[model samples]
Structure formats: C-alpha cells, structure tokens
Target: MQDWAGVFIPLVLFILLSPGLLFQIPGKCRIIEFGNFHTSAISIIVHAILFFSLAAIFLVAIGVQMNLGP
Candidate 1:
C-alpha cells in the first residue's frame, strides 16, 4: 500500500504532466513538432506550472507526507 502509493503516485503525475500526452496546449511553434500536431514552448511552461500546482493540491488532499529524513 504505502510502497505502491510512493511509486504509483509519482508515475501518474509524470504521465499526466507529459507534454501532448494529456494536454494539447496551443501557441506559435511546436515544443515537439510532429508534422502538424504540436505544442508550443509558452504553452508547455504554463501547463507545467498548472500541472505542478494541481499535483501539490492533490498530494495535500491525499495527506501524503513529504519528509527529508527518518
């Protein structure tokens, strides 16, 4: 349970935060251009912030502790 949470939670966050996998933020040029479909630099930055913020809120809501040492 605890071990699963530790691994699963961060893995989920990483997938969710990955560019173009979940979010399709638009802008001028593509962050990782693949023909026509692509994401922009500014949009990537903005979405990264948004995703991190949401992740923080979620972690807090789930009462996940962040400790440095034992």
Candidate 2:
C-alpha cells in the first residue's frame, strides 16, 4: 500500500548505496602500505553523504506522511 512506499524508498536507496560504501575496502588495504589516506577519506565522505541523504529523505517523507495523517 502507500504506507509501504515510505519504508521501501529508503530501503532501496540503502541497498543501492551499500556497494559504494564497501567498494574501497581492498583499495584501503593496499593504500595503507603506500601511506595514502585519500581513498579512505573519499570513502568516508561518500558513505556519510549517502547515509545522511537517505536519513533526511526518510525523515521528510515521514514528516509529510504524519502531517497528512493515516
């Protein structure tokens, strides 16, 4: 139902972003030897943005749903 859309959007977004969040692990291991910190820094920023954007979108959706009532 429409209620489910509220839950599904964030779930789908999170699932899609999960791969990007994990993509730098091997690169991180290799980069450690070279003392290169940029890989991890970029990964952190990407993940933080992904997570916060999803959270903000979900919050806004929920707020609108609440304002509209059940």
Candidate 3:
C-alpha cells in the first residue's frame, strides 16, 4: 500500500497538471507548431521548464515519502 501511494502521488500530480492536454491544441496555428512542437526556442522554454520542474518535484516528493516508509 505504501509503495502504491508513492506511485500514485506523482501520477495524481501529473493528472492534475494535465500537461498532456497541451498536445490537444490544434496544430494549425504557426505559433503552436513552431513555438512548442518544432523547436525548443525561447518562446517555449518557460513552459517547458515549468512542466518538467513541476513533474520532477512531485515525483521526488513521492520518492522521499516512499523511502521514509509508513
């Protein structure tokens, strides 16, 4: 159960963040395609950093809790 909690914590955070939903936007817009999908230029860097940093933080918290044990 504790191990499951560790796994679910990050999963829950990711679901709440809904980062995958970003991909659902239509690709027709030049900014969407060029800014996010095509390259990691200045335009999309902030968003990319935010998503990964949040994900890493959540996962690390889960890992720490798991290591501490019940």
Candidate 4:
C-alpha cells in the first residue's frame, strides 16, 4: 500500500482551503451570484460537497491502482 500520510496530507490541506477561497473571489454571472452570509454559506457547502465527492473518487481510484500493483 502507499503511505497513507503521503497520499492524504495534501488532499486534507487542499480540501480545507479551496472552498473558502471562493469567498475571496468576487463577481457575478448568470449561474452564480455573490452575496449575503446565507447565500455564501450555501454556495460554500455545495462547493465542499462537490470537492469531497471528486476527492473521494480520486482516492478510491488511487487505492485500487495501488492494490493492483506489486
């Protein structure tokens, strides 16, 4: 197996920071509107969920690949 620490450490840090970085960005489009606390929280939650799901997929794929290797 791969070293779990090495595999997961950066993912943990990135997962923590990226979603909040959205708040620092400012602009509006037809799809996204930046605004008050409630809306911002909802958007962040959605982003976190999306990020977590993608991360899980990647981690699972990596684990499978590692398991299949010598």
Which candidate number would show the highest lDDT if scored against the true structure? 1
Worst 10 residues of 4 by lDDT: 21-30
Candidate 1 — what's its lDDT? 0.61
lDDT of 3 at 54: 70
TM-score of each: 0.52, 0.38, 0.31, 0.42
In terms of TM-score, which candidate is strongest? 1
Clashing pairs in 2: none
Instruction: Give lDDT tens digits, candidate 2, residues 1-70.
Output: 2545466666766665553333443355553223233355566666568766876767675553423335
Write down the lDDT that model 4 would get. Answer: 0.49
lDDT of 4 by residue, 17-46 (tens): 353343312223335433422334555566
RMSD of each: 6.5, 8.2, 7.0, 6.4
The TM-score that candidate 1 achieves is: 0.52
Ranking by TM-score: 1, 4, 2, 3
- What's the lDDT of the predicted structure labeled candidate 2? 0.54
Q: Rate the local accuracy (lDDT) of all candidates.
A: 0.61, 0.54, 0.48, 0.49
lDDT of 1 by residue, 1-64 (tens): 1335445566787776666666555535543433344566776787688777766776756757
Runs in model 4 deviating more than 4 A are 1-17, 20-29, 32-39, 62-70
